[model samples]
Target: MLALDNIETFRGPAKILHGISMKIEEGEVVAIVGRNGAGKITTMESIIGLLRVKSGQISFRGENITRMSAHSIARRGIGFSPGDCGLFSSLSVQENLEIGRWHADPKRIDKMADGDTLEKRVYSVFPEIEGFKRRNSLKLSGGQRKMVAISRAMYLCPSLLLIDEAFEGLAPVVISRFRDALKKIKEMGITLLMAESNFSNASLVADRVYVLDRGEVLYEGKPKDAMNDPRVKKILQG
Candidate 1:
């Protein structure tokens, strides 16, 4: 339900996304695969309005949001979890989530679900978060931190979730848990757009894959075909 049309964005004076375009249908999981500096995060940021698009349009559910502010975009049912996890180290996990819940617009919740609130949805996906609600975010392990970040973003009750570097630096076991959670999210009718450096891992969850190189789309096809491409595999392996 999200579409990017010939979007060209820049970071400072340097252009980073060269007419990037893609579409994400509702209830589908799409992955953008690339090495560092391949415009993966840039594309996500542009869509979420963290970075403005210099040229082209971004539409969510047929509404143009290219010039919308980041807060407005979030209020319009777009959840974003940046690569850094963006947690408040001094706050308790619950406190962090409370901020997100407070800021989120409940109307953004998808209509297809059983009308569960954002808090309920997040807790359902991550029971571990409930147990750690009182703990300081700074004290959690890496995987726990990632879980908390994802949970916090879910407080937005978004129809679409955009995650950047979601699979980096996690052990296989931890990654598996996140995978299950992501699957659960899809079942809830929320679309996912995950940016990953690991093509192999991205392939496991993605229905479609887009391989990017130096700000351009080099390949767009099924995950299997993208993985089988020597160029994509070599860049991912590096």
Candidate 2:
């Protein structure tokens, strides 16, 4: 559902992603794993058009979206959930989700008319959210806030979801909840490309893994195989 071909990204003169290439098939849960400075987030930003591409191409569903703006790409069926969980602190749970549904194109909204299903599924995955639906976002626990952020993104029902660091700094139980939610999302036929620093948590959820080191894709394979690689071990344990 998503493909990146030799894509390069730079912040001013400092190159962050060095000829990165990867593909995510429909309904697949793909994880990009890396240490602190591996450019994993930069790669994701490039794909979602948050960063300018210095070279190479990005394609989604057979269309070249290399030059598309972030808003345009999102309208084209890509949902992004950054590490910060981009939520409006003042908005209630349902109100926050409504913002995600406010895309420019009316046709795109019609195409993604699964908001009811999305709400039901998200609330099912996070039953706690249902109780807190009327609460302010800033009043939520860290994990609960994260759920709100993810649910808002999923409210649009994008074909491909780019998730950055969903499990960072959370308790194990919360991480488990998030992992289960991700699996449910995959079962619903939406593709996922996630950037995670936690190897064990990622291994539990990812079907395939790509290991990046120093802004380069050093390894890519099945999650089990990638987890066993010496390089991957070094990077994760170092």
Candidate 3:
């Protein structure tokens, strides 16, 4: 549902993505895999319009979004969950989720089935967060904060979700939970574009993997194939 064609992005005076190109089909979980400083997050920011691209084009569901503002792109059914779990420190978990709801396009909400609501969709993937709704966001543990971030993104009722470093720094058990949650999200028909520094972690849920190095695509194919490729192995081992 998303396509980036020979896109180049810059952060300040330095170019971060050098003609990066990739594609995500509807309902697929695609992973941008690379080591630190490999431009995975840059790619995410470019697609979300957080960082404007200097060249090339980005299209979602067949419409060009290269020049759209972040809010406009979001309104077109894209949601982002940043790596740092960008929740308001002073707000309760419930309030953080409510803010996401406020950004939802009313016309999209009206199109949902009679009984479906944004809360239901979010809770479906992260039921644990509901129990701590009244808790201050800053008081939650790391895993809880991550869940809230993803849940808040779900609140946008997006067709495409861009999650940067979904499993970074989490304990193995927490990672497993997120994997299951992501699978549930895919079953619900939402397309996921995840940026992960660890190839193994990305492979756990990604249908297709793109290995990026130095702001360029090094490999693009099935996770299994990438695992066995000698060049990919070299990058993974480091």
Candidate 4:
């Protein structure tokens, strides 16, 4: 459903992604895996148009999105969850979720296009959110905040979800809950593209993995294969 061809990205004067290319098929969970400073996030920003590419092309749903703005790309049904979670500390959980609803128009929603409302989809993946829906976001625990971030993204009813470091810094139990939630999202037929620095975490949810080093693709294959590859092991160790 998405393809990047030799896409190069720059951060200030420095190039961050050097001719990076990859593909994600519909309904598949794909991962961009690498250590810190490997440009995993840069690749994502390049795809979503947060950072304009210096060269090459990005195509989503068969249409070129290289020069599209982030708002425009999101309108086409792409949801992004930043690594920091990006929740509104001053707002009630319900109010935070309402912002995502702005992405959906009365004439056209995403998978929620089937008649289900945006709020229902968020609560479906994160039923726990309902319990604290009226609470100020600053009062919640780290896990709860993460759920709010995911739910807010779901409020857009997106077909593709780009989650940055979804498993990072969470308790193992919390990670397990997110894994289950992601599974449900997959079952709902939403494509997932997760950026992860930890190999083990990426393997937990990805069907296919792309190892990025420095600013380019180091390897691309199934998660199992990537785990066993000696080269990948060395790259991760260093």
Candidate 5:
């Protein structure tokens, strides 16, 4: 239910996304696959309004949000889990989540799962996090940090979730765990848009894949076809 129409954005003095256009249907999992500097995070930032769009439009559920502030966009039902897993190191895991839960607009909760409380939904997606609630965020491992970040975003009760670098450096087993959580998230009716560097890992979870190179879309098709394309292989290989 999110669409980016020929949007161009800049990270700062330099432009990063060049007329990038993509769409995510309701309940769909879409992946933007690219290597470093391919504009994946730029795309996510633009969508979330962390970086303003210089040209074109960004619409969620049919309403334009191109100029909306980051918090405004978030209030409209978009949750972002940044690649760096933005968390307050001094806070306990529960405290971090409490901050998220505090900012949530209760109306954003999915009607289809109205019976489930927001806390229940978050715990369902990540049952493990429930056990680590009292632990300090700085004490957690890399994968645990990622889990906490995603869980914090889920506390927002979003209809569309934007996750950057969801599979960046985790071990295979931990990646598998996240994959299972993603499946459960989609089943719960939340749309997912992920920025991933690993094409094979992204393909396994995404229904559609977009290969971006140098801030432009080089391929937009099935993961299998993208994997076999000479140009895609060339760009991803490097």
Candidate 6:
């Protein structure tokens, strides 16, 4: 569903991603694992057009979108849920969801007219969010805020999703809830590329894993294989 070929990005003269290449198939969950400043987030930003590409190409659904703006990329069926969650503190849960609704394609809306199905599905995966539907988003806990952020992204019904640090700063129970929700998202045919620091939690949902270090893709393979690699172990430990 998405492919990045020899992508390179730089901050002024300093290079970040060095010819990074990867592909994510439809309905597959791919994890990008790395330590701080390893360029995992930079790679994602390049894919979603937050950062301009210095070289290489990015393609989505057979179309080259190397220079597309973030909004254009998003309109082309990619939804991004960043680590910060990007919630409007003043908006109620229903109001926040309404923003996502505006971004949905007309064809998708026609196919799923009820719209309630999306809300129900989100609430099903995040039962805690249902109770907070009428509450202000700013009033919720960290995990609950993350749920709202993810739900808003899902409401767009995008073909592909780029998630950053979904497991960060939350309790284990909330992480488990996110894992289940991600599985459900895969079942619904949304391809995912998640950048996470927590390898164990990422492995639970990722079909494949890519290991990056010092702005390079050091390893790429099955999660189990990457997990067992001595280099991976060394990097994680260091």
Best by the TM-score measure:
3
Tens-place lDDT digits, model 2, residues 138-161: 888888888887777777668888
Tens digit of per-residue lDDT, candidate 3, span 46-69: 999999999999999999999999
What TM-score, over all chains together, does every model reach?
0.94, 0.93, 0.97, 0.95, 0.96, 0.93
Overall lDDT per candidate, in order of appearance: 0.88, 0.84, 0.92, 0.88, 0.89, 0.86
Largest lDDT belongs to which candidate? 3
At residue 45, what lDDT does model 1 achieve?
Answer: 96
In candidate 5, what are the lDDT values of residues 1-238, reduced to their tens digit?
Answer: 8889999998778989999999889999999999899999999999999999999999999999999999988878899999999989999999998877777776665453547876787888888888899999999988889888988888887889999988788998889999998899888788999999999899879999999999999999888889688989998886
**Per-candidate alpha-carbon RMSD to the true structure:** 1.7, 2.0, 1.0, 1.6, 1.3, 1.8
Q: 50-160 in candidate 1: lDDT tens per residue?
A: 998999999999999999999999988898888889899989999988887787775655553576677778878888888889999998988888888888878877789
lDDT of 6 by residue, 45-131 (tens): 998899999999999999999999988887777888888888898899889987877887757656654654777767776778778
| Off by more than 4 A, model 2 | 104-116
> Model 2 lDDT vs. the true structure?
0.84
By summed lDDT, which 10 consecutive residues of candidate 3 come out lowest? Answer: 104-113
* Pick by lDDT: 1 or 3, better one: 3
TM-score sort, best first: 3, 5, 4, 1, 6, 2
Off by over 4 Å in 3: none
Of 2 and 4, the candidate ranking higher by lDDT: 4
lDDT per residue, candidate 4, 61-116, as tens digits? 99999999998888788888889888888899999988888775545464245567
